[model samples]
Target chain A: MQPPVLELVDLKKNIKNKEIIRGINLTLGPAEILGFLGPNGAGKTTTIRMIVGLIRPTAGSVKICGYSIADDFIRAMSNVGCIIESPEMYKFLSGMENLRQLSNMDKRITRQRVDEVVELVGLQKRIEDKVSTYSLGMRQRLGIAQALLCRPKLLILDEPVNGLDPAGITEFRNLIRRLAHEEEMAIFVSSHLLSEAQLMCDQVAIIRQGSIVKTATVKDILNTETVEWRLDNPVKAARLLKEKWGIEALRENGNTITAAVGENRLELINQVFVNEGIELRYSIPRQNTLEDMFLDLTEGDEIA
Target chain B: MLRLIENEVFKIIFKKRLLIVFGILLVLITAFAYGQDNSLNRTKARLAGRIGITASTDWKKLCEQQIIDLKNRLESPYGHEEDKPATRVRIEQLQYYLENNINPLDSSAAKFTTQFMEQSIFLFLPLLIIILAGDIVSGEAANGTIKLILTRNIPRWKVLLSKLAALLMLEIIVLLMAAVISAAVSGVFFGYGGWTAPVATGFRVIGDRLETLGVVNVPQWQYALMVYGLAYFVSIVVGTVSFMISVLVKSTSASIGVMMSALIGGNFLSHFMSDWKITRYLFMVNLRLTDYLAGSFQPVAGINMAFSVTVLSVWAVAALAISFVYFMRQDILV
Candidate 1:
């Protein structure tokens, strides 16, 4: 099997000896989107910076498409396209001029490529206007347009949708998904908006206090051990499950009882509820969202 | 590397203040030329008034009459020994003009060009440089756009080099604009041609007396070029220091403010503390490189062309090196 598009091994950072990022390891393959979740000052931006070569890592290395960032910075960065934080632009320049300036950094970005990106990001109408006249959402589109011009194989976006409206976010999300699948590019996105990440990403890596606490597929995070049960007379249902199966009830809402489900617990719970003559409305596995899972994992810490 | 510099150029011209600055500069040059033209006309009328008293058209007799007028002025208390050599040189020049049947009071554009170069070295160009170069590095940092560029595959030193190249290009353009406007406006007010007219330079002031023993005469056009040559050198030296300061600071406004303060403060201190030996080493003192060309008095004696060039070069090189080193090592926080 080929190496993943991006691989981090024991990535660590220490600023003033305080350990900003501590031992981060991750792998992202082509055509995949990994959501990076962390609280405020949890070192998401620091890790992104280290990956893009903005700040040197104190220890360990990042490999992009088999090129080591520390040893072959240019080659590694060449395959990567990133937007860290809100997309700030050269406000004095026209949108077209700004794109042209970025295009000059590489020779392969032809005029046709520039037009293709402008079309991709839907900025053709106001491309000639100075960026000072642009709304924050327009700048975001322009930033993404520039990132795509070089046909990068890995994309990193840090809070890329902060200033975007709902419609713009939807469009941006669709565009990112298309880029990942069509171009076979890996994407690493760090966002505080868990709902957006849930809808957009394939996997999520939850970070706490600079250490990654969990890295799981979105399906796995959404379908963890927690299971919800809907029952008539849920107080009686919870007592019957505790007494009959020696299982503890985790949470009880008005019409529902949720708990840490054991292996094959669905059928067992239904059989126990039926045998005890406790009225049960329905028993279905709850589809958890990324927000619920993230809150559960991060414990409601501040998100920077 | 060249493309990076092209990107930098795009950024600078995109700034709206560029055209505004050039406009003010041209208007000021025109106004200054108009004023100088009026003053020259007044001087010519006064000289003609003195000449009208003479009955003969004989050149030697007219020269003698002008010499007598200068002598009367020198006899007054306002004229000190310090003015003697320049006055004597002027009298000799008039004698030579009379003998050659030349118009001594022609008021050519060459004189205005020289004056413009001399004033611009101390004032106009440095201010323009401070406003433009001041924003080159720090503006990006403050705007957080620096993260985009630094994350590119290029080395940090090359990025600094691109900015430095853009700055140097802007400095050259400023110098060229100074030369162009001064010549064009003054040429409109006064007659256009003075290329071959003699300009006497290399007079030294020795012990309260102006010495002219080694005076050399060059054509006015050559003299204008020499003046701008020295002014251009000072512009580079001053502009580079401003670029380095821009790298050190994080905001465009603060960078421009800091550099402007140093320029204004340096000039202010040079005026008040010129007698101090340490004052001679200040970059502001060395900004007056054209003063050496005119053989003017040194604020601190023994400061000369070679010394000023060496000091300014050292400062410029040091500032440039520091800018590269700091930018290369700096962590992009934004």
Candidate 2:
């Protein structure tokens, strides 16, 4: 229904004959959060960099808000907000002053917009403090505040919650969710923490060895592989599931049965195992988690 | 571009370091003027005392008597004017006055008083330039602000142009401060209205047969302006070169060290290159813009105003080109 806010088509990046990002294709749509998941050297940062125009792609092209990154750099960049690596800022300046100066780069971002974004990032109380005195979490919040100044259509943050403490991480997660939910911004965030991605993102693209191994909705990815289910009786459920419901399944050990589950299989199996005469200690359907899925996808290739 | 240049110019002119440099120059210029003024006053007083005695105040007759007294006392060669050029010239010129009534020292008192202002413009202003121009860009790079500036998505050319504008503004400010301090201090000591003052230098080499231009009498104000302008230009060229080296080198110390070495080395090499036949192209030779004030030939024999202008212009352009090319393409890993 809505045009993609940010799109990368078969992008490749090479440096000194070493390929960093090998053909990554991704699309971010309105009010969608795409979790870009990968290991440390799996081209996660490089792909995000190309999207934000920090570096040029060796091949393919990137488009932000329907504008080509190469042909219309200013316009494309105008629609995208990005935080690359750690928050690099002028430490000598106050957070508010830093935001004010960066906001001046684009003519459209006014003083009111800077104030609004500062408040949105929950840095209103400490905006006047110099960045040199900010803790890692506070700096991260300021970085996000700077990115949101123009209310960009697309926001790219690489490991946005990397250095946040537990409470800070909770606050950042809620703030990102609110920005996407209320502001209707397409959010593309990359992180190595699969649990963080699962809790934050609606859609995701998993990268391994500079290639996108899997991309889908969170439910679809969690459904891709079967999870090993542990039970009190084990082999009885696999035999019963296969024989009774014509389901494909596998038995791991005396107390565990592994089966690929569909969307409503959890409810169906709980009913089915209760209806049967087996002593149902636990009848939960086994579905692959994001962590397991990430490992399965990236396990075959060299990380760097 | 103008806005960027304005911001940069404001930063340079308002920087505390530049203010400190101006303050140092002001102190040195004031001290030199005060010191020179005291010596001039003492000389004037001694000459006045020689001329003020009664019975026509015959200073030469009295000096001769004093010399005879000294000769009788110490067996020294006294009152002989034939050996040393300066003393011989002074004694011979005073001989007529010794026969008449004019005191020899009072004859040149007006000339000495007039030339002191010109000497300030020539000598102290160049030192002021050296202090500011030596560290223009190196200071920014040393503070790690260059990368922060470059990442603003402002074009690389704009960044360099801004820096050049800043350096140019500081150079002008320093030059103006020197000029004002010189004018004010000289006015305080020598009492202003002698602006048509004459200046003299010891060695004026007259060239052969090209319309023999005699002693050039530049008004004291014009001489000050010319010396300040030329000194400012020389300082700006050095500042631009130092900026280029700052962009090229990794460390600020190295940038300052290299440019200062090149500056000192250029002057040192120019001394030997007088016989080298190609010393005219060296930027250091044109540094003595005051030589033109004395109605003499330019520094490197045949390199006139047009040649000095061309060489200095070329150096400035080349330095700017190298700075832009290197800075735009540098990988800002910092």
Q: Report the C-alpha displacement of residue B245, candidate 2, in angstroms.
A: 3.8
**Cα lDDT of model 1 by residue, B1-334, tens digit:** 9999999987888785567668877998998999888876665556657776422244455556777787677677788765665565455556555655555555677778888878778767788878778989999999988988887777778889999998888777877777787878899998778878887667565533445667677888898889988877888888899999999999999999998888888888777776678877778777887876666565555666788899999999999999988997777786
Looking only at chain A, give the TM-score of model 1 against the true structure: 0.88
TM-score for each predicted model, relative to the true structure: 0.87, 0.70
Model 1 Cα lDDT, one tens digit per residue, A157-242: 99989889999999999999999899988999999899899889999999988899988898776665666777777788778768
DockQ of candidate model 1: 0.64
The candidate that wins on lDDT is 1
In candidate 2, position A281 carries an lDDT of 60
Question: Residue A180 of candidate 1: its Cα lDDT?
Answer: 89
lDDT of 2: 0.67
- Candidate 2 lDDT over A234-270, as tens digits, reads 5667877778777777776677677776666676676
Error of 2 at A268 (Å): 9.4
Among all windows of ten consecutive residues in candidate 2 chain B, which has the lowest summed lDDT? B203-212
